[model samples]
Target: MATAHTHVTKQQAPPHRAAELSAFGVLILLAGAFLPIMDFFITNVALPSIDTSLHASAASLQLVIAGYGVAYAALLVLGGRLGDSYGRRRLFLIALVGFVLASLACGLAPGVGVLIAARIVQGATAALLVPQVLATFHHALEGERKARALGLYGATSGIAAVVGQLVGGLLVGADIAGTSWRPIFLVNVPIGLVVLLVAARIVPGTRSEHPVGVDVPGTVLFAATLVTLLVPLTEGHSLGWPWWTWVLLALAVILGAVTYGVEKRAERRGEVPLLPPSLLRLPSMSRGLVMVLAFSIGFGAFMFVFALTVQDGLHADALHGGLAILPMALLFFAGSVVAPRLLSRFGRAAMSAGAVLQLAGLAWLVAVLLADWPHVYLWAMAAPMALAGAGQSVLFAGLFRSVLADVPAHLGGIGSGALITLQQSGLALGVATLGTVYIGLAPHGASHAFAAVEYVHMGIVALLAVGVAALPRFTRATPVTPVTES
Candidate 1:
């Protein structure tokens, strides 16, 4: 018996050590994830300053936001494929360097055109950087460690948007030697440099065992499809709904069909497509992706509209606008930290509960706004915002887990890419669609516009709650031990 126990211990020791990702290493990976998302929202609060400093038109400002989002969404799958074929750590380091360079260009840009171009490049590099974080988590950790790491990732994502607004407000308000909006982009420099340096020493290298080459035709079609779809949605209203915008929207649908057909044919021919059709066939992946899209749309709309309402409607400064959302950010982090425990106990029902909580919070917020109208204090909205934040964090963590749970390890990069692409696209769409509505109605009354948007948010969350009921119950299973590379 003693000899058997000793033999088993010897066999288990190496795998145990191999599975360990140091706390610092995990932090570095999470930072990489945080920067890209934060950059997206940071610019929201800085737009006014940018307009003043650069003398940019409303259309140009919209382009600045759209360019980054379109590039990021279009290239994400390619980034994932590159990481799988090349090396995740190598790609991550390279992308981080590129992101920092692009940030510098944005900060130093003398004209609106240059800023737009730089933002696009920044978004492209971000595509390369973000997927690697999720791939690493999938490849390097498992069991309880994996669950906790994912929870932290969810927390990081949820908080980064609010932090972006807060940090952007602070930096812009500071005027940092009269630099105005420039510091928002420049802020990424030192942080990226430090993370890049530490990541080189700590992050384990990983890649697919049977890596495939890039699918050229599929890449072009996919890029074109997303450009047609996203460009119009993001820029249409700002540009006064031109004929070209409608044309592009129509083209997007046709191109989307072609892309799907092309991908299906490639799969049938035993060729690797940019997006593997087989991956979407998994019930969990498909259902979870739909949930992610719905949830993200509401989240995106809320952030954008709330910022505008507080600043433009309430006539609050950028600093005060950011402060108003601080409670939500704090509660979101708290909920995310405890998500793993919640999941272990309540399973899929936890997601349902979260959605209900979010709906309740939204309803409360709407009621408060209706009562106070133009005089509503920011603090009056804090409790509901905190409740909504906690609920969102819980649902976000659950959806992330469900989406990736059944994805084969070899396809982790693509899966992560797909998940994030939908998320980013949904966010952009939210800003475009509901943002247009709010802008149109604002001329009548800010309070009415705000309440209408919140009502839409409530409807979205209600749909999510209903969708959660359809998800299959979670079944406890033994965790797979992943093999990590150095």
Candidate 2:
């Protein structure tokens, strides 16, 4: 149950003045949404170059990846709460500025330690900035406009993952005056500066009227739980599954229980818990998260594992490795652009179709890879990749809308935060688990290992398809709207 403190606060201005977002404002928000996701995947192809340059061990390399991801995932809910309490525009600019600086630090770091430290800060700031984009859209847009805006957001997400790798490959190949992988992070500086300028001018400020109390104990316990779970998973293979790994995993379970207890207590006290347990009662939100976890696991595993397989197994150059995914990326963009229109007609059928297509693509890919093996080139992989990308585009384009269809506007920040938290967690866990599986098997043979993982991913896609089939279809009568604060 919502507390007495949860009522809407007085508006700073008239309602209409606060309600609308200009077109340029939407563009600026999309840019904000795009960069962080791109950065997440950009480093994939560059990891080998980084290891060579820094002489870093396998464990340290995993840290570089997991440190950014873990911090981002753990703090996302708190980040959302901060924006909800403060002004979203205010927090967004602050995080963006910090993101630019962190990128610079990551670019200039002399060693793995410094790079890892800088990346953690980078991810934390991303946690702060990303939710604001969606929350802002949820608040400012309505009806068809909202659907369109969300489709863009979904498209941007899929595009960034592919582009990150593409850009990483290009930057590494260009060597940008012999700086090599450093240029990938440094490239964000100018783009960020531009985004900050536009955002300051156009991004309207909005926050919940209700005063939100910081749930400190809940936040701490949540962070501890994620760290314990993610760290051990990410590092276990590199560290040879040390005794501490099992200890940390066990600790994660205890921390999770303690977190639940703390949240329940906060609810009894009529306080705003970090992630309101009550919100999970929303059936659409709950089911959508399940689909998010399943889809993201497949998506995340595909990107990380594909990069390694192409570059290491096939001995493809960084440019070639990045280009290999281009068909999927292009088709994904097309599918995302087309999905909003389809949703109006087919509703949840689009998602089911997407799932089917993705499964088909995976099956096709596995067969081709198995048949072609060492002889496979970018062209040979293009057909299945395009199909898979198109399918992914359709699935993600509608997922956010389906999830938030029932969420109230007042809880937009927390809702968006919750969605992204699950997404990042899925990504992290996918890498930790599937990545470990592939990495473990690589010593035997790279192609065979990659093919083995593809089969596993096929099963994951099939499971996600079943989940999509179960989602309630959207209808004209069930229009998507922002939930107003009580």
Candidate 1 residues lying further than 4 Å off, grouped into runs, are 1-21, 140-147, 405-413, 475-486
| Global lDDT of each candidate | 0.77, 0.79
Best-performing candidate as measured by lDDT: 2
Clashing pairs in 2: 408-483, 409-483
Clashing pairs in 1: none
Candidate 1 lDDT tens digits, 189-274: 99999999999988888776545567788889888987887778767767788999999999999999999899878767666577
Top candidate on TM-score is 2
Q: What is the C-alpha RMSD of each candidate to the true structure, in Å?
A: 6.4, 2.9
TM-score of each model, in listed order:
0.89, 0.92
**Cα lDDT tens digits for candidate 2, 1-486:** 556235322222333325488888888888987888898888888878898899987667667777787788887777766776787889889999999999999999999999999999999999888877876776677777876676567778779988888889888878888898899999889999999999898888887655366678987888889889988887899889999999999999999999988887786666757766777568878898888887777778788888888888888878888888888889988886787778768878887788889889878887787788878877988999999989978777667667776766655545666777788888877777788888889889887788788788888877777787666667632322221221
Candidate 1 root-mean-square deviation in Å: 6.4
